[model samples]
Target chain A: MSLSIRHSWFEATARQRLAGLLDPGSFCEFLPPAVAQPSPHLAQLDLPGAFDDGVVVGAGQLGSRQVLVAAQEGQFMGGAVGEIHGAKIVGLLRRAVAERPAAVLFLIDSGGVRLHEANAGLIAISEIMRAVLDARAAGVPVVALVGGSCGAFGGMGIVAKLCSAVVMSEEGRLALSGPEVIETVAGVEEFDAKDRALVWRVTGGKHRYLMDDCAALVDDDIAAFRRGSIELLDDWQETPDTLARLRAKQARLQGRLSAYGRCRDGLEIWAALGISEPERVPLLDCDELIALKEGLPT
Target chain B: MEKLEFKFPSQALLAAAPPALCGVVGSGNLEILVRSGVDRQICEISVNTSARGFGETWRAVLATFAASQAVGGTSIAINDMGATPAVVSLRLAQALADYRGGAQ
Candidate 1:
């Protein structure tokens, strides 16, 4: 099949994916690129200005309901979030509350933030976390979509976990620290960073779905992803009791810390989750996997 | 300490400006920011990297980048850490490419 830019995995930019998700002519972009605001530090270094800070944050209509969408351009520094990037996200989310949109959809595909501006990125993430909680407090259901190559990591991974509903594609991989770092810490004998299979087994969607980190898993196609997202959005108007759910999930995460502290493998989590065939867990298809076990809502 | 090296790629002769920038800021990773430069007619690129002394390397990469893409007056900026040369090049090019076209 011919490859379309809109579906070109990592090569395809954020706007391309959003175009596919929303109806043509329905998307009204906010903060177009003409408004270039670079950090003073970046300018001091003679650095080029960031276009949209690698993220496209705005509002668009998915159908009849006007939804707020934040799609990351993975092409731009792996769609990382910086100060302005994070600010735009949180600011728009507040707008969602006031506007009373049907739902909030996040197309997360980032390694997290730019290290050059580490302070700015960190602050943005903190603000974003606050916004996520604020959205919940305001009775807005937040949904996370992780189907891009970046998959969400670092601080963004924690934000994804906080979302009310999460839809992960088969290719989705989520983790706080990437495997390469783990290998650096554990040594190659303990872990190999280049091993694709090993990496997936450790952090791929299949593992997260079975472990209940991800609520649903679908195909990589944007249509499929969009449909799954819209499905969750169906209940967007009726916000979930997000704080209680978060409290419960928070307890579970804390439980992971206490029960399986620093155990970093799919098999380990599978065993902890009581799967008899820890080895077979990774190989199971979606249907069989779902039948194999029920998951905790995150 | 052993330092890491990488390159950020971006080129657009006649392109639009970027709206924002972001990325993770870990030891081996980095986030970049891009947008319109002082001039809207020239495709510009800026890189903030932890691995110093790669100034020539960045220039070479950026020079080649300028030659590769037909950029309109556009400015580029990047803030990075010790990312691999591959990731830097990919992010820069990706961001610039998105500026010309729509981001996926």
Candidate 2:
């Protein structure tokens, strides 16, 4: 394949993302399209089914380290977690526990559970969550990379948080209820779905990174993500999932709620955190934002 | 959804290589998964497309693809979501290239 100067992770397909993120000629896919393990439920609903569902799972080399990776195809069904899709992810996570890779890099770009296979999708997400925790508890780091067209939302948002660390790009959104879903259920007065700025301000990577929700934020390019992953892995010291760690995480979340529970927007939270020009936060690039965050007062 | 299958006589077999996949099953796009080990003189194609009543279009496209490319001894399965004939042809060529390139 011809090399592009900058390949946008958001623009690449699930398979393409795997090819770009891993080392050259390193990826070996699991349950690839030729296997034809499509969703058993979509056919009943008269929907077109993809051969490998909407997610690709496999083991590949990230730099010199062997890492198991799973990437959701956001273009198909919004990269929703259907029964088979969820199962593929869950299986990969479980395998991570057995064949402990250096890390499990989860490329999240889903809108959460596939609504067409509602109950099954929900069950699959739950299983995936457990499998992720199980892998982490077994001393494997599960890192999440969220920079895709669909972004990460709903149960997948919670899943991303459950990982050992999350790396995101400014365009990557991470949240529970998506902007459109919130607007549909709570009225536009509460959250305007059409206002892309507001949507990003609330759930985008900059906000998440400032809030200490994500471990790192990088540019939208695939190489940036690969570099970010390498940096994190280089600094990785396996911290077993212990009760004390859980308590500390809970306390940090509690502190965040106490500090900015009533904040109306991300700008308000940024101002409360002592940012001089919160309004300009959205315009800053990844390096500038990281510098800004570092310059903030504790 | 519609399913169409076609087989074309080919002049030469594709060079032995690993299976290859190309494209995405997104809006106005399709994915082609090509695997070897079919009849040495025939190229078999199967399509599962969202748009129904386009069997003739798919047949023509696959026929041209078989004629132009040395895709014999391969089975190509496509999952399409209303991709245009141009996209179908492009993905077919790309997939064949990837297969011949001997990379997965």
Candidate 3:
């Protein structure tokens, strides 16, 4: 299907992306800005505070089925989670468990916690993690869209991994620690922060998809994202075999850890995965990259 | 640690419902939250800024916003972080415009 150049999901704002993902005219925001739910912690520190605390939370319809939706504003403090923002997400997830929505979609772009309110942000993330698991346990499928510039890092990366499925765009990145942080701690030889290509190879969507860390990989278009999400929701069931899936995921994660535990670069892991020319994968587009990973005719 | 509150008369009313927000609280930036007000003819405003000794500047900016009469029946709450007067006015204008169903 052809995509419009104007509707690049990577460049769109969180609100625009949410509107595109949801069925038209079905979004209803909860605890909007007028509620004045800005973080008090920032005020105490004399820091600037956004009205919704960098998050837009609400309910929307995805193909006639009601779903809970939350999108982080990556431009706002790098979409960090503070006290109020964390509470809003945790509240929504908890409500989803009771409301039993068709699914929960988190357009995750956060770099994790707001360093200004470190303790509260950490605790709030813990609560959100618990809430995601709760919603999952209640039979609500949770899907994460990690396609923004901020991508997902720190606690949010773990949360995205915990979700039922993760859909990613080629520009999206996913990792526990950001490249700069890793470079600062692991030394320049281990991970160079200035090397853009190296950074993408380490955490970009193509690498994550090849590593089996992501479920669906698509082009940077909102239509692609919407289609991917609707397709997943259509096949969604109550997960009677959740335990088996969990075990399989755990084993896969463990296998990945062992496989790359000693590797200094992403190319080493790709080479181990039997890619004839690991260096060339980074140059391929989404479809070609996935096909190459799966050894399919491209 | 500076905080100020003011109310001004306006002719235009919100085009949509209450609770429209605009901007982010990044460095040298600000965020404005616009809510439904008690009086349809008045626009109430409350500003909290990290920069001290900017009360006159803030009042001047807000007063200019009020005279434009672009919005009414709204209470705007601002959280600022050392933003310049231009940015301050832009955020306030954006908030009012957004409350009137304009793009933010």
**Interface root-mean-square deviation, each candidate:** 8.2, 1.1, 2.1
* Shift in Å, residue A202, candidate 2: 0.4
Judge the docking of candidate 1 as incorrect, acceptable, medium or high. Answer: incorrect
Calculate DockQ per candidate and list them: 0.09, 0.72, 0.59
Q: Supply fnat for every model shown.
A: 0.06, 0.67, 0.76
Off by over 4 Å in 1: A1-11, A38-40, A236-247, A250-263, A271-288, A291-298, B1-104
Q: Candidate 3: what is its chain A TM-score? A: 0.93
All candidates in order of DockQ, best leading: 2, 3, 1
In Å, residue A249's CA in model 2 sits off its true spot by: 2.5
- Can you write out model 1's per-residue Cα lDDT over B1-104, one digit (the tens) per residue? 11233333334445444454434433455555555555444555656666767877777766776677655465555556567777767766766655656533
Candidate 3 DockQ, CA atoms: 0.59
Off by over 4 Å in 2: A1-4
TM-score per candidate, in order?
A: 0.68, 0.96, 0.89
* Residue pairs that clash (backbone atoms under 3 angstroms), model 2: none
lDDT of 3 by residue, A87-155 (tens): 999999999999999999999998998899899899999999999989998899889999998999999
